[model samples]
Target: MLPTFAADDYIELAADLPATLQAAIERDLGIDPAQYLANAEAARAASDVATALRAQGVDILGTSIDGQDVTYNVADEADAALAEAAGAEVTVGPIELLDSGREVQPAQDHKGGYGYAYQVAEADETGSFPLSRCSVGFSGFDADGNDRYLTAGHCGVDEETGEQFTYPVHHIELSEPIWATEDWANEFPGPELGEFVPGSMHFGEQHDGGLVDITNPDWTGVPQVAGWAGGSGAPDENSVTIRGPIDAVTGAQACKSGATSGWTCGEILVPAQSTPVGAQDVTGFIFNACLLGGDSGGSVVVGNYALGVNSGSTHDGRTECDSWVPATGPDDTTGDFSIGYSLSTGEYNALTLLGSEWELSVAINTPQVTSPEDGGQTGPTPTFTGTVEAARSTHRVEVTVDGEQSYEGTIADDGTFSVAATEALAPGEHTYEVVATYGNHSRSEVASGTFTSTEVQAEALTVESPTNGQTTDNPRPSFTGTGQPGATVTLAVGDEVLGEATVAEDGTWTIAPSADLPVGERFDATVTQAFEGDSQVVTVSDLGITAAPVTITAPEDGSTVAGDVVFSGTAFAGATIGLAIEGVVTESSERVQTAADEWEGELVVGEDGSWTFTPAEELRDGEYTLTATATLDGGDPELTSSEASVSFTVGAEGDDDGGELPDTGSSNVWMIVVGVGLLVAGGVAIAIRARRGGSTA
Candidate 1:
């Protein structure tokens, strides 16, 4: 078992703790103390090397450590050898490092407006009617202590002129009437209305960000970012604070606060990525968090550290917003991906674009949990312990079991606290939450863990092979589990008996169903153990049986043909046929109704399980891969029979005689015309002779 800590706590403790203290902390937390210390040291050493390389102008993406080995995530694989020679292990990342050009679009309608995080502003074109809504990135001051704020460069640019500056920005915070038009010259100093000016914009080939000058004295900027209190909880007073920028690594949890989605947390998919958006290229990190239109310029943070700025989502294909849409049914498959520009790059660009006069920084760091690990499993009476960085402050830690407060406690002087559940937990998996609050109601992000409570006196039953929720192509799955020694075990599906086995001397049992289970049916596998007059039952839910395999026969692979081509295949009877010709799916006819069970359309499958397909139109002269897929009715649509594909080529066109047609031109036409003329002259003479003879008679 490994000790668990909050992500931020792990990073801090790993980098700053003494070796002896690290070991003692790990041991107390039920983790490998020695290995943890070694890994920490190695990680710190690797970070130093990375920092040096970065200072020397190397484009290192990020770095992570596992045990005593460090893996450097770099864009270029050629740098692997050089990084390894620098005294630590290294690996190349799959991300490409490219620049993203200017991003622009028309403004959108919003429900309401606010000052802090979700404040909305519009950028209007100089002589046109185009405008766009954008959010404020963060607040910072120039070297001269002048107030300024940051936003996306695309937000300030005029789409028609392709220019950044000269565009008028309008906001309601300091402006009177809040919804005034962009007639800046006449609207200036008019009562309660005011217009903000654009100072500088950078649509660098590598980044799409900019800084806007907030000249109004009535408007103020805060050092804190907008987010949920704990990374995953609801928005509150103790949401998040801005610390300095921190290097982002893969597998770390990151959150995004935007005007659209508010705050959502997801793991960092790629620490460094360079991808193309339309004509422009963007270089940054890819996260699994959801982003939407008008979310640009939002902050991407990890705990107290500002990591990146929201750029755009990959789901947007330039036509419409492709934000995450939840799956509607069991077969509905949809996904959305988001991208952000690293704060490290953003900071550099900020200084270069706005001149080295501006200084950027964040507010205070929220308290963090450092023990009992999130999402860990333990006994029913598991001990809950954690620590906060705030010293000499009264800390109250609330422990909630399945969303209800069960226990509360106070922290000790050493920044540590523990609590034991007073009530007994039932035999099953239960979720527990630990929320630590310190100093004037300031609360740390909530920490959560899950634990399963098993009765000591009851026989421990655990499903071993063909684990719970396992999907298999084989209808008859092998089931194995451990139970009380000499106990009789019977496995069943609903009311149907599968098989039975007796626990051996070692307390293990195995069984297999005598008959194949129906495909696509979700059923629970109940394991019953009877001892004396008592019985125990454990179930594995959602075991899936997949479709059978299939094969294509005629129009053999690697053969050339033309005209009407025939495609045949063999599949199980009553199975649905999916045919694709040159990557385009063809409509399928109903299941064969005849005794032989033959199905027909562009493709035909016989009841004997043999199938054939003939294209309705003449086959084009080109190489193609004809694919046939079989699907069973009750199973998942994604889980179907093995696809059968045949590659064949269509040759040149043919004639009526099955060969090239003979050429006939002007000569044949002239001969037919002359023969008709001669026949007509002879027929006229014969008619004249016959008329004369009849007059003489």
Candidate 2:
């Protein structure tokens, strides 16, 4: 009966391995023991990733685990986009089979050989003995520290019936070894080492295993797998170590070394199915490897971890096991059909079938980072969290966001951990990495992800007054707006800051320009609100805020009048209203106008911004144009209105205007003489009118 273990045991597997096993681990996997263990934990974590991908509708062909990476194989190249989005490398096609780089396996002879019967002699070179050709899988140790052997159950039991049979284990010492650290193998099997344990042999649809009590300690430790040389009968090459549980996922490679077909390799196939084995029909996973008789019960491994035992292959044991016929479908069982049984499914575990005490050693598993999932979004102050197995309290965490160290500390051993960011993170996509560096009873582990950092937003900023396309005469106009409290708003003319203010507690802001805004023409005003290192800006253009529009607004524009002509119109209440009669009618008209443009007296604009002028003198019959304009009182005289004209004619072209002009066809010299004659009189009349002037408001 295969037993069960806690969830923790399924993730990380750690051990203080024998020095020989350590050496073998580095020799084959080319990595230290700690990394190998951490990688196993990382590989286990990928099951959840596959689940996530499936949830996204991506059909995974297979999966291969190596070191810290898990490569997924998919049929369609388009699936790559979906796989990578979930943070997994994708291979578009079947598994890639790597050459074993070993020697041709030993010759196979069918002995009705459900297994082989190798020759053996005494340890002192005495006599001959009996040995099964069925291959040995992984070695292990019982809780009592006693060495044990693991192999296919069918090797020591009846596949059709359930009856068990005892098989003697053999061993020998080599005088001249071939590429080996220690010189001992079952080549020319020596003496009997041990027999298969009673009740340990069992074969069914789900499980197949038999345990052996290896009394002789000559073999590699429980953490190591045996190796074989090219065309050699003795099992000499012993450098491959058992790191952790094999990745049972498809697209992973299965390698083994057995009594016959010594060292053969194959890659996992897609869509696992069951095949008939004697009376029961149960298979683990499928692969495209070539296997023959005497190879059954051999070790099935992926990477450096122990998987299970070789169950069956389509190639009969009678012929040379050289040709490989890749299976086209699950029903295509004629050739290249091979199968393996996994040690543990979610419900079944054959590794501990013998007893809970008997076990294989493995490396430590890595902790998984669960925070900031790839392509996720979070606030500036994001917290880091993750799931871990074993030694929770001793695991120290160090975190970095976008290459900047964001956190570093220890976590509780509650199978999970959480670390808050010490400082605010910047905006945008930030790649974060988490390292479980210093942990008691555990090796270092690395986890990483990316998330978009977004800032907390306040209300939108707005300007209430000085809106787009507004016209005003007030130079230092008070600007107002509604925005986030404490935000600063500044109005600028070109590059010059006109006014600035901070929004009050009521979310309202007002600004009085430090200097008057430009006048007399349309320009643009930029209003910006800045808060928390970010700013929002808006521009208001074509603001009609210039010199006051002081246009002549009377005399019935284009009207005709006779001698007693009075030119009057609106202007700045405090400014002067002056009329200039020019053109052909100038010489015959009287000077009934204010000398404000000439700066004779200040014409202060009234509070109502309006003023009118009443002339005193009458005009001679002639064609004349009247233009009235206003000038600022206490400012630059050039700041006068460039306003439109209010034109009128005295004895000018009109509908029977004022009878006929006195000088309608007169010579210019005579008209000038007449105007000069009236100049002194007009001056005297203006002086009298100024003295008698009334309020122009």
Candidate 3:
């Protein structure tokens, strides 16, 4: 709960504290001890009249106390005695006196007035009429949404025209009486009479109070030449007074009010008094602000809040006064300028009774944390913050994070509170709950929100196969590697999920289906790996499979071959195999399987030597035997037979028929001889023809 001002502290102590400290307290707690004391004192002084007027209804004009109105004078011995008797140092002023007509203009005689100074408007344009000096003032709103200026009851006439109102005089350098003529006065100092605003219905003509609505709808212009020029000094709480049980009696410790000169503090001068209503005695308090003519309708407040309006003052024990002259005459001005009357609680009750009033009440929805998604790899943290307003004092709040209670707090006297979560949350869906607390009266509805913590990591899973574009039935096939683990791994293309695998505990993981892997179709897989508070992610690739298991064939080994020597083999579709002579491949001896399990191609071999055929689809002639391979489904490979070699012999030039052909390790020597004889015969024929031609030439 907010702390209230003490009943005794004063302005001296409040001003003594460091400005920074005082400002900090005011910012945080909204009150100062000394300021509260001053307000209480002011209220005590005002209450003397308040109590009496609340009981009765009019101001007793003849009862003057120290130059203040007798019905509501703070310095009056009777009022002070009554206060002390009632167990308070001062009386709280119920300063809500509605003025009949009066605008809050600039103070006129600051030196001679009480809290402020003001000038009263005269009726005649000749400037020969009597004008009262004003001091007290108050601020309020009128029916037309205009600022209503208030002041003393005796400031002027037009009780028939409307409330005794005044106008805002901004400038302080010009003439004495501003807006003297009716035409000029009608522009500002005048107001509509039919509304009868600023007049308390129940306290008509009781407290000698009056009110006037500032005519301009928008009055942002600077003050007139005769106005107070915006006086300094905000209200000081330490100057007020307190009396009565504030909650029970409709009487608070202190009320606040403002005037043409500045803001001021006062107390209810009386509890209950019998005073005059238009020459008839009614009851009310007399505040101690030492006011004059213009202060008529100035506002009175308590604890930084508005309370009442300033009204009439009386001739009392003040200096320089001979007799009790009428308040309008100059003789009464010399006595004292520090007294005024205000409406009593009864008057305000009667006016406000059964009327539609707007109370201060508002509520804001609880905030929700935004960010990290549950089980997500990348996002923000879980958190939320904001405020709510409750009109009553019994409100409390409950806060939860991730579906768990995190904090609980109570609303202060001003109806404000806050809550925070306890610990950092993980990535994933989280829900918060805020429930209002109360007793039998009924609790407020609960509000909730959902949010996520940081996001999780994403890892990709991939697999590579042997053949580029082939499928086979090979078992125990070889694979290149596995993809990153913890990622959702599927072996398929598009929307299809072929074979699936979760990344193993280690970085590498493999998925081998129990059944034969699908042939022809493509597969893709994905996985999520949470890390770094689930904030980082990575994706890898999965390659399509190539199949294997090929068959290859070649000539005998350790023999030379020439011409276009053809080699054939069966390999997985899109599989390539090489044919080599001896340990080196023949020039252009590469062959590829155009279709599944079928391959054939020709390679030129030369001289008597071994031609090895190796499994290579595209390569230069080299010294390697031909071997075959096939790719099965899911792109795995199976090896075929070892390299097979081919050999062939070429006869030497001019060799006889009996001379053995260059041995290519032939099993039959005679067969080689025959082959050599045929080659020699062909050479001899060509030579013979050439010799005959030369002889003929």
Best by TM-score: 2
How much is the lDDT of residue 160 in candidate 3? 44
lDDT of 1 at 201: 56
Error of 1 at 488 (Å): 77
Whole-model Cα lDDT of every candidate shown, in order: 0.51, 0.54, 0.34
TM-score ranking, best first: 2, 1, 3
lDDT of 3 by residue, 6-83 (tens): 434456655643343344335322456465545443443443444444344333222222212122324455655664
Worst 10 residues of 3 by lDDT: 685-694
Residues 1-697, candidate 1: write the lDDT tens digits. Answer: 1222334445643444233323323432234423343333333344446776667555576765333345666667567656656544566764323233323222121111112221132435654243345555665665555555655555555435556545344552222111223332333323221223344555447665666565656655555664332221223323344534555555445566655445555555556665553344566666666555656766776544556667776444332323444222112224345667665542334334554644454442233454435555454555677665532223567788888748988876456777877766676788877776532323456677776655435467677877677888888988898988767788888788889898888888998888887676566788888643336888888788766667767678888776467667787666666655441111123211111111122444566556655533454344456666677666566555557878776663221122211111222111100011011211110000000001110
Local accuracy of candidate 2 as per-residue lDDT tens digits, 1-697: 1112232442333244323333434543355545544554454455446656777988776566544457777778778888877667888886543222122221121000112333332235565444444666666666665666666666676434566755465543422112222123344446555667778766675566666666654543435545443222334443355544544665444555555555455556632444555555554566655566666666766546566767666654433444555554334435365666566522334654664746654433365777667788876777778865543443577787778666886766355778877667788988987766432222345676788988957557787888887877798888888888877799898999988898899999998989977655567888898765456987877775546656655567777766665444555434554444443323323333322211012222345456444333345444455555556555444454545565566564533322322321212111111111123322311111211132221
Model 1 regions more than 4 Å off: 1-49, 53-70, 74-87, 92-131, 165-199, 228-236, 315-335, 346-357, 364-697
**For candidate 3, what is the lDDT?**
0.34
Instruction: Please give the lDDT score at residue 562 for candidate 1.
Output: 60
